[model samples]
Target: MNDDELVNRLKEIIIEEEIDIIIVGEPVTLAGYASEQTQKSREFAQLLEKYLTVPVKLFDERLTSRRADAATLGATMPTRNRDELAAMFLLQDYLDKQKSNNF
Candidate 1:
């Protein structure tokens, strides 16, 4: 989806689910490397903040997408990587980090 569409969709989900926070998945490259696409995640966070009432945060999404891709490859059925699962991993990773820092 495009930027506007993504923002709209996130707003809808936030409203529908009464979500308190939005954590965006930002996958780095192998061995914890950031790439040019990382800028897009920042832009997305900015758009989300502008459009939504709730807070949006970016979390290190390293290996989450890769794990999902591996799972799809291992599955018996012909499945593909899912963005939602990646998002879930992103949120969980953020939560884990917060707990680690006592934040």
Candidate 2:
């Protein structure tokens, strides 16, 4: 999805879920370096910070998509994309941090 679509969708989610924090999946390469998409994601996170009252952060998304794909690849494959898996991983990381911090 484009930035405009993402921003709009995020707004809806925030309103619906009463979300306190927006954790974005950081796009990193296999070598643990930032990918080209990192800049775009960071920009998106910045934009989200401006529009939403909640805090926004970029959580490392390394191997999450791969792990998700691996988990499903063994079974009947669902037609899921990398982005969805990556988003799940990012959300999990945020949730874990929240749990630790008692947020």
Candidate 3:
């Protein structure tokens, strides 16, 4: 879906799920350098902030895909499933960091 469609869908989900915030994955190189995808992610986050009621935060997603692949090494799954797993890793990391900061 396009950005407009994505924004509309996210808005619906935020209300339907009563989500307080949105965590977006920020893809960067292993060396922690910003790449083209990182720029795209930032732009998308800006778009989300402009259109959505919930706050949008970007979290480092480096190595998430690799971790997902390792976690599913022996399993056979579609690419989309792997992508979803990577997203889970990203969100979990974000939450973990938030929890640590609260202490």
Candidate 4:
């Protein structure tokens, strides 16, 4: 879907789900340069932040899909590197970092 569609859907979900924070997955190339996907994700986050009251944070999403795929391997119904699964891994990592930094 396009960025506009994604932003609109996220707005709807934020309201419907009463979301407090938004964690955007930033696509970082292994070489450390920004790829087209990174640019698109940044644009999406920028658009989303305009309409959101809560904080919108970008998390590094390098290899998250691969990690998700590896984690679900040997399972009967793996998520097949689904975007949601990747996002979950990103968010979990973000949360873990936050927890660690809290100390």
Residue pairs in collision within model 1: none
Residue pairs in collision within model 3: none
| TM-score-superior candidate, 2 or 3 | 3
Per-residue lDDT of 1-103 in model 3, one digit per residue for the tens?
A: 9988988898898889999999999998999999999999999899999999889999999999889999998488898999999999999999999999999
Off-target runs (Cα >4 Å) in candidate 4 are 1-8, 74-81
Give the per-residue lDDT digits (tens) of candidate 2, residues 12-96: 9889988888787887787878767988888878888887778888887877877777756745455466557657877877788
- lDDT (CA) per prediction: 0.76, 0.78, 0.93, 0.84
Best by TM-score: 3
The best-first sequence of candidates by lDDT reads 3, 4, 2, 1
**Which should have the higher lDDT, number 1 or number 4?**
4
lDDT score at residue 2, model 4, on the 0-100 scale = 85
- Ordered by TM-score, highest first, the candidates read 3, 4, 1, 2
How big is the RMSD of model 1? 2.8
So what's the TM-score on candidate 3?
A: 0.95
| Model 2 ranges with Cα > 4 A deviation | 1-8, 74-82, 97-103
- Give lDDT tens digits, candidate 4, residues 15-101: 999999999889999987899999998987888789777789988999898877777773545454466788888999999999999
Give each model a TM-score: 0.74, 0.73, 0.95, 0.80
Task: Give per-residue CA lDDT, model 1, range 1-103, as digits (tens).
Answer: 8878877888888788989988877767767777778878877788888888998888888878666667577554433336666666777778888899995
